[model samples]
Target: MPDLVAIASPGRRRQIIIRSAASCSPLGGALARAGILVLPAPPPGRREGSPAGEGTTNMGLQPPQGSCRGGVPWGAWGTVCTALCCADGLVYALGGMGPDTAPQAQVRVYEPRQDCWLSLPSMPTPCYGASTFLHGNKIYVLGGRQGKLPVTAFEAFDLEARTWTRHPSLPSRRAFAGCAMAEGSVFSLGGLQQPGPHNFYSRPHFVNTVETFDLEHGSWTKLPRGLRMRDKRADFVVGALGGHIVAVGGLGNQPCPLGSAEGFSLARRRWEVLPTMPTARCSCSSLQAGPRLFVIGGVAQGPSQAVEALCLRDGV
Candidate 1:
């Protein structure tokens, strides 16, 4: 087992001192005893979007001290749980729920050398709780929620052109789905969705669908059912690590947040479960920095201020 150490946090952040494997089980029982809510995922269609069940407050997370990695200036909109990506020598803050709980299309970029944010062209459709991934010089926005309704619009922003263009919208609507670019194509993984009148599922079900959009052919194809994720999860994190697409902690078919994680191998074409996250939480923010994936700010028991990172070298 990897060693668990307590590192002092900067600023107002508390030191997350998970001392030893003996004390901290893979189920994160230690965290649960410490006032962290590790409840299993509630039933589907119970109130939608949030995994906290109905009437439970959304984990409006604040970045822990030193969790933002390259000293990213606080976003102009003061948002939380937003998609922040670093590419082409700049940090991009895309659509996320503003501090006031409203969807925002605001796009801001931070130039490290200049130490300032420059407003870019806003997304054509404003949304919060959306996820963004970069391919080549463009940023793609996937499904997100707006006022309890899922936004199915799929749009991309060209870095050079500074404009948004609509691509093929998702075949079905979903919110808080996980997306990652691999082998020159973009992959949309599982997420929660409510049943639409015309839908095939006919009932709200946690999904394990895997759809890939080929940039070259400009077409979308759903992988076979056998190729779907082993776990039905949403509000998770997806990134390419060790040459494989890995899905981190999120809410699934349980009453509590899932600690289990998995990675998809193109060669093996199977989702292989990895070690569970030391801290089980949903709605956490994940960012790939160097050889590690930083998982920050999500709800475990309640709104969490804990931060943890999975060193990519472990998988490689």
Candidate 2:
């Protein structure tokens, strides 16, 4: 009865898999409501690309039900937050909105071994939808929205030290920006540059600017003007693959969502246009496994169920 499940994706290296939460009951009647069931475990020595048996871990306790199901503990439950699985197999939940729609500074971690969540030191900045990247023991959180407006607060949490660190804020205010790690740096890509003190009378607009936070230098560096993304977009799905940062479909200046895709090469130090997505979309959920970056359900004309992936091999 486990809600969250990780399974090996088919036809790939078989070493990497995608973890997703279960959303529906297979049997939709009284049998489904029994509140008790068994989930088979993956058979030992099973071949890759094979289907996984219906499975749930037997923690010796019934899976949580009702609103409590898939819900975070009291301190970390809210919308527009980021939940990321680190190399240590722990789920780290970062800044999000609280019940009153106010931003929260709280940080929490889910311990699957004990089937419980533990609170951690709160972040110095309170905001939701911040882009986060895990580098070594530090989790860097970048710009996120505060209510309808965007904030430039940048922060990080040290997993080993059990402490929080405030880094230099983003040089500019950007909402829906994409964050990725490449070549020992945290790269922040295009987004809607909102109006600020310098542009109070101007309306929010999309930008193609790119910036990077060097892990070694410990400072933010704006890429040269020529290195900016070719397309002006916000809320794009971005991931680092094959020594390049790939930006998938997202909202652009057009009335419809964008389908164009582009990649920024770390070695080349410039943006290059790539193959367009089969389906145009924005605000899509993304997952990276090995060389493939999966772009899942997102808005098109309406709510969409499209799923597509971009793969990189030998710098192709």
Candidate 3:
């Protein structure tokens, strides 16, 4: 049986609980204590020596002390940054809001082998909540916000050259959009479209606009009107799976969060409704592993402990 390694937090302490993926039965002892809130997924290709249902030592990801920018606590780097593991197994932290709530242009890379962080060239556009993708040899950063206002900046960082290159900005400004790459194209999905200078008095609203940046063509193209997402959503979990783009729970036009899910088939060129998510929430962290898209902790009334995965139906 395959073992599932679950990262759990009980009280203020973090623990790793390993168990059978099929049974999910507790292996007993102190490791099986209750109040496990969230599950932070291990990087893909990680392996364990223990058999299924055997708990491992209590381990957590903690940056080396005095290793962050200016020797500040790693937690001091405020939330809302783009952190992703590259092909080299190194973690890269890109533009985000600083402790003072100002947008930052800093870029830092963490080497797990050495257990230390090192700085790289700063990004050309300094913003937070940007959509990023690791595509062959470069990391593409798309639309992001500056002090609650969206910017059209699009840039890329060359991993080999260690330099930043400016690309064509987004066709329109959007915040909290979902982005994923498939078949040599970068797809930008639903988000909240804020009002511009011409309509500054208008309220911000959710949009279902869909656009794609063709890497080979070096340009952006908006999908046809009929091909847009069925639901206007923002802060959702999206990923590419089985020749389709799946979008999970997020904030819609309603007072409560949306539980609806849908998938856009690249071959069919239309969005198909999927089963509703078990938990209705927004602002969740997501990670794509093979055919599974894991949506982790988010808000459901308040902070939610729900960790759910949206998988494709059998036989596609």
Q: Give the winner by TM-score: 1 or 3.
A: 3
> Which residue ranges in model 3 land beyond 4 Å of their true spot?
1-85, 313-315
TM-scores vs. true structure, each candidate: 0.70, 0.77, 0.76
User: Candidate 3, 287: how far from true, in Å?
Assistant: 1.3
> Model 1's lDDT to the true fold?
0.65
Using alpha carbons, what is the TM-score of model 2? 0.77
Question: Considering only N, C-alpha and C atoms within 3 Å, which residue pairs clash in candidate 3?
Answer: none
**Weakest 10 consecutive residues of candidate 1 by summed lDDT:** 11-20
Candidate 3 per-residue lDDT over residues 176-217, each given as its tens digit: 888888889888998999887798688888999999989888
- Give residue 13's error in model 3 in angstroms: 29
lDDT of 1 by residue, 1-316 (tens): 1122222111211212121122223435444444332222232222222223343233343333223233332344355445555565565667777768888888876554543456788888888767677777787887788876778778988988888999887877776688887798888888887677576666666788898889888888989988888889988877777767888888888999877788888767788877788989877655455566657666777766666777655345
Give Cα distance to truth, residue 3, candidate 1, Å.
29
Best model per TM-score: 2
lDDT of 2 by residue, 154-177 (tens): 787887888887778888888998
Report the C-alpha displacement of residue 268, candidate 3, in angstroms: 0.9
Q: In what order do the candidates fall by TM-score, top score first?
A: 2, 3, 1
